[model samples]
Target: MFSPEGPTLRELAVQALSSVEHGYDLLAPKFDHTPFRTPDTVLESVAKALGPLGPFEDGLDLCCGTGAGTDVLAGLCHRSVTGVDFSAGMLDVARRRATGPVERVPAGPGTPGVAWVRGDARALPFTAAFDLVVSFGAFGHFLPRELPGLFTQVHSVLRPGGRFAFPVLAPPRPASPAFWMLLGFDAVMRVRNAVWRPPFVMYYRAFRLGQVLEELTRAGFTVDLRALPEFGRRDGGSPRARLVVARRPDGATPPPAA
Candidate 1:
C-alpha cells in the first residue's frame, strides 16, 4: 500500500524496470510513504528486543535506506552510528534526516553521532569498526548464493563478539492468499529478468531462514533467535516474527578498526 505522496504507478513501473540501485535512487524521495519501507512498529520491537544484549559502542546499519534502523542504533550505541547503502539518493535523504527535527528515540547524554556512507553490502568498507550491525528489509536484493559473501562482509566489519542482527518474518502458509501473491510476484520478477537488462532483484521467497542460519554458521557466527512477541504467534503457535542475532566469536582475532 502507498500513500498519496508515494510514487505514482507509472513512476513505480519506471523504477521496476531500472537497475536495483537506480530504482531505489528514483524511489528514495518517497520511500517512507510506501509500504516497502520497514514499519516503525518493527523497528521499535527490534530495539526493545536488542536492548538487554547491548550497551554497544560503535554500530553500523548495513543497507540502511533513509536511516530508520540507524536511528535505533543511535539510542543503543554509545560512540557512533554509521549507515551504509549503495544508493546515493537514499544516502542523501538519510543525511538530511539525521540533521532534521524528526522524533527519534531519545539517546541520553552520550547520543552517538551518525554518518552516512555509500557502499555495496557484498564489500563493506569498514575494518572491525563496529560492535553491532543491524539491517532491516534489505536482504531480498541479494540472491541466495550471495549469502555467504554477504555474511562474510558483515563478519569482517564487526569486532570480535560483536553482533549482526536483523528481523525476519515467518513465511506465509501455502494455503494463504499472501503466499500466492508473493509467489506470483517472484514469478513475474523472474520472467522480467529473463528479458530485462540490469536485473531488478527482489524476491519474497528466496531468503529462507534455515539456509540463512546455516550460512551464518558457516561464516563463523554463533547464531541465536529471539521471538518478537509483539507480532504475536501463528495458528501453529510459532512466532510470526523473529530476531536473528549472530555473533562473531570473541576468540577470533580481527584487524584493528579503521
Candidate 2:
C-alpha cells in the first residue's frame, strides 16, 4: 500500500481482517516499503542518543520487524544483539536483513553480533539476558490493560541495571488534524473489533504516555526521558519525540509477599 513494492490495497484489506500474528506474516515481506517500518532518521537518532549510555554486553530489539532496531543495537552494543518477534515471516525478513547491507554505528570500538528469534512480547522467553532492549512502532498492537504484563516481561529479560527504551512522539495537539485522524482511526478499529471475531487489538489512541509511565514504574523500572534532538521541538518547547529509557534496578526479583 505504500509503494510499488508494498502490499496492494486488496492485500492490506485481507491482512487487516486477519489475526494480528497472521496479518504481520502477510505483511512481513513488504513491511519495509510501508510507513510502518521505523524511519532511518529515527533509528539514527536513537543510535546517537544511545551511544553514550552503552558498552552494553547483550541487547535486544523487542518486536523487531525487519531488523531496523537490531541494526541500531549492532552499532551500540559491544557483545551481542537479538531481535525477537512473534511472526515467522517477519523473522525471516529480519534474518535476511542481518545478512544483507549492515547498518554501521560507530558507538564504540567493537561490532556486536546479531541474531533473530520469533517470540511473543507479552510472554518473552528469556531471563536476565539483555542489557538494553528497544522496540519501535509495535506498541499499538498491545491493549492498554496488557501494559503491565508486557512491561513486566521486558523487565524479566533485562539484566539488573538494563534499559528498556523506545521513542514516543508527543501526542498531537487536540485541535490538530493529526489528532482527529488518530481519533477516527481508533473509532474505526473499535467498531471493527466489536463485530469481528478474534479481534485485531490495534488502536492508535490506546497507549497514553501517562498510563505507560505508570506501568513502567510499577514494573520496577526507574524511568527517564531523553530528548531526540533530530526531530526538533514543539512550540511549547517539549521535544517532538522523546526516548523513554526505563532501567531495571540491580536486585533479585522479590518473592510474592504472603
Candidate 3:
C-alpha cells in the first residue's frame, strides 16, 4: 500500500509515538507517498459526482492534508479555493504542491488563486464564507462524541444552502477479514491510548456512517447521500463509497447553543 517514497516503518513508529499535531507535522513531508493519502481515483470520482452541484464561488477543503481535496476545490470553485489544516508542516507541502506540475480542471479564467490556511476543524476561523466545504480521509481523527461540535463547526462556516460534503466508504462486513483487521486496529489503539502519553488519535474503525448522518442532522444540516458508482457495489448492491452531502438551509438560523 506504500511505496519506497513513503516513510519507513521506523519513521512511522516514531511519528505514531508523537502527539497528533506533532506526529502529522513529522509525517507531512512523506504523506503523499503513503497509503494514508487520498487516492487520485477517489478524488476524481468525487469531483465528477460534485461537478453538477458546482460553479461554486468559494470552497474550503477541511483537514486538507497535503491538499488532495484542494485540487478538487480548485477545479469546481470559481471565486477562490482555500485548504485549512492545523499542521503547518502539512500546509507547507500543500502550498508547494500548488506550484507543482499537477494539472487540474480549470474553474475558468475568472477563478481566483488557491490559498492554504492553518486552522483547527473543531473551531474554524471563517463564518458564512464558503459555498462548498469538503473533507477527505480525516474523520477517524475525531471521536464519535466530538461529532456534534465538529458538524456544528462545519455548519457555522457555510453560507445558508452551502454544502458540507465528504465521502464515506461502506464498512466491511463483520465476518470479513478487512473488518477484523480494522476492529483489531481500534482495539490496539484503545489499549495504546490508555498507556501512551500524548496519544495518537487515529482509529480505522471508529467512524460509523449511521452515527455521522444522525449528527449531521442534529447540527441542522439537511443531509443526502449519493452513491459513487466508480467503486462498484457489494452483493446487496450498495455502492462501495457514498458522498454525504449536507446543506445548511438557506437563510436558516442555527439552533440555540447549550
- lDDT scores of the candidates, listed in order: 0.91, 0.86, 0.88
| Higher-ranked by TM-score: 2 or 3 | 3
The residue ranges of model 1 lying beyond 4 angstroms of the native Cα positions read 100-108, 253-258
TM-score of 2: 0.93
> How do the candidates rank by TM-score, highest first?
3, 1, 2
lDDT of 2 by residue, 1-258 (tens): 388899999988888898999999999999999988999999999889888887798889999988898888878788778889999999988887675333323334576667777789988888889999999999999988888889988888898889999999999999999999999989998999899977887887898999999888888889999999999999999999999999988984622211
Model 2, total clashes: 1
Residue-level lDDT tens digits of model 3 in 94-119: 98878532322343576556878889
Worst 10 residues of 1 by lDDT: 99-108
Model 3 residue 213 distance off true place after TM-score fit, in angstroms: 0.7
Candidate 3 lowest-lDDT run of ten:
99-108
Structural similarity to truth (TM-score) of each candidate: 0.94, 0.93, 0.95
Q: lDDT value for candidate 3?
A: 0.88
Q: What is the lDDT of residue 74 in candidate 2?
A: 79
